[model samples]
Target: MSARLYVGLMSGTSMDGIDCALARCDERGTTLLATYEHPIPPATKQRIVEISRPGDNEIERMGALDRELGHLFAKATLSLLSKEQVPSTEICAIGSHGQTIRHHPPSSHQPSEQGFTLQIGDPNTIAQSTGITTVADFRRRDIAVGGEGAPLAPAFHAAAFAKAGHTRAIVNIGGIANVSLLHSEGQVLGFDTGPGNTLLDHWINRQLGQAYDKDGQWSAAGSIRPDLLARLLEHDYLSQSGPRSTGKEVFNLAWLDECLADLSSPATPQEVQSTLAEFSAESIARGIAQCEVPVSEVYVCGGGARNSDLMRRLAAKLGTATLETTASLGIEPEWVEAAAFAWLAWRSMAQLAGNIPAVTGAQEEVILGGIYPGARPRTQ
Candidate 1:
């Protein structure tokens, strides 16, 4: 089979922007061709944050925002295609990892409830606007068959990074960090490693009115509060075994404030940010240590990979293991997640399983996402 063009669209927990990646994939492998970041206005981001938590008139807000995002995504896709001078008709499909608003895992606090996740961006609107087959709503099917319905990037990490005799780990630090442990013996295991940039970003945003602590500069200027770091580390979620996952729902401002309330003395904003950075690094290191077999190399990806101070903290925590970005493997750190979704779309079109049962605790491997045919589609 020949490689076909596919575009993957992602709006992560940060709500910073939408990542759009263009890739060509076939039986041989996948290649990253180009990429784009579509900005999200402050108003849109605030509304998204509001919708993430409970509030009145949610359905109305959610409905309008969902369609709004769809249009945004389509515009971004078309913009990318135009820049590359590639017509929509030449594209095979679009894999959209729409913004995740709420994620309730079965393993977490919600025991009796069937775990569910909601990522809203109308795929129908995307397909209609872009004239490309769209594959979306990728998490629910995994949840339906007894899974966390998350950490979907592990499946892609295994495919793209794993080698026959090398045991490696791929850690993607978005709002929520997730680690993929690829055993040399061919088994893939992983789970979310607590809050990634969620605490750090939110803390800085509140204190200095900055979008984020660029390169971890603000946190670097502060001192780590030992008592506070210890308190954050004691979180119950850290002890949970695999097949587990989490989201902002459990690690938001409320949770952070609750932790702060337990402190002996009030912490300065910078100190709190410093403690949160260490807390993020520790949770990630602890998660990797849980791998049944030791990981020889640690490959980092996502927005957090660009934070020098966080990377230094992680290096010390992960001592001896080689630390580097996915760029070593040909894909830039920022593009990995978007590329993964594009790869997943190709898998869906091929009727191949995209979820790893062992990694997600699914009953079996299954092809993820629902397919929305393009404007010109009639035959499969």
Candidate 2:
């Protein structure tokens, strides 16, 4: 089979910036050829945080950000290609996951119509600016067909990381953590485990005026408070089972404050951050443990893979299972998600099913995303 190039753009829940990747995708799978991290301006990130919830002038704020974000995505794509010295003409397509501001999957078995998700970086702008077919709005099609429309990367994980005769769980610790269970017997499952780094990120940002904990050094310095950990673990989201998804909407600062208020004693800022780390590790480990198959190895990816303290906590809880990053599978931890969107773009262009029904709780398999045609290359 002939291999073709594709680009993937993802900002994720962290809003750190855009992660743009150029990949070579074929029938077997996609290989990340190069990656670039384009930082989002502080003010733009702040606007994203505010609009994540609700605020006055919502339409106007979102409207402006939508166009601006598209330009950023376009620029990121061009920069990555330039860094690799690859021509846009060589790429088959671009998959832009955009920035997710709100995600509300139906709480129950209500019709898919009841749930909606919004990820806003304009594909039209990308198609026009980059001169490559763009596939965006990847989730809504799955949602329309009664799917959770998330953890989409699990399908890619099963192909790239799954080991024959070994049950491995891929835990993606973004702002919200989700797991992909690849059983030894050929069954795959996935769901959101609960909070990931969002709570710790928010808690630390509130106390220290920093963007992030920088490898979780602050949390490592403080002791994990038992009471706070217990209180956080009691959340209803963590207790749920089966195909599910979550985002900043459900796990944010306000909810964190409410949990703190329920604590009998006030937990110091650093203590809260420490407990949040344990909180994330426990939830992720618990989710992996609850799956039908016994997981033999656990691979950590996304932003949390870089956190040494979080990795230590996760390793302690995994017991006998091995804990490692996606790098062991030939791709870097941070690049995994972006690589997924690139694979998805390949699937989209080929008119193939991208979502796994078993993982997403979708009624049936469907081709995800809408494509926008790009300007044809001039014949020279």
lDDT of each: 0.89, 0.87
**Candidate 1 regions with alpha-carbon error over 4 angstroms:** 1-3, 109-111, 376-380
TM-score of decoy 2? 0.96
Question: Best candidate per lDDT, number?
Answer: 1
Candidate with the greatest TM-score versus the true structure:
1
- Residues 268-344, candidate 2: write the lDDT tens digits: 88888888999999999999998786788999999999999999999999989999998888999999899999999
* Candidate 1: tens digits of C-alpha lDDT, residues 1-380: 12398999999998879899999977768888999998888888888888998999999999999998888888888888888877787789999999899998677645666778899999999998887999999999998888889889998898888999998999999999999999998889988989999989998888898988899999988999998888888889998888889999888888889989999999999999999999999999999999887777999999999999999999998867899999999999999999999999999999988898787889988889999998963221
Off by over 4 Å in 2: 1-3, 108-113, 376-380
Give lDDT: candidate 2, residue 152.
92
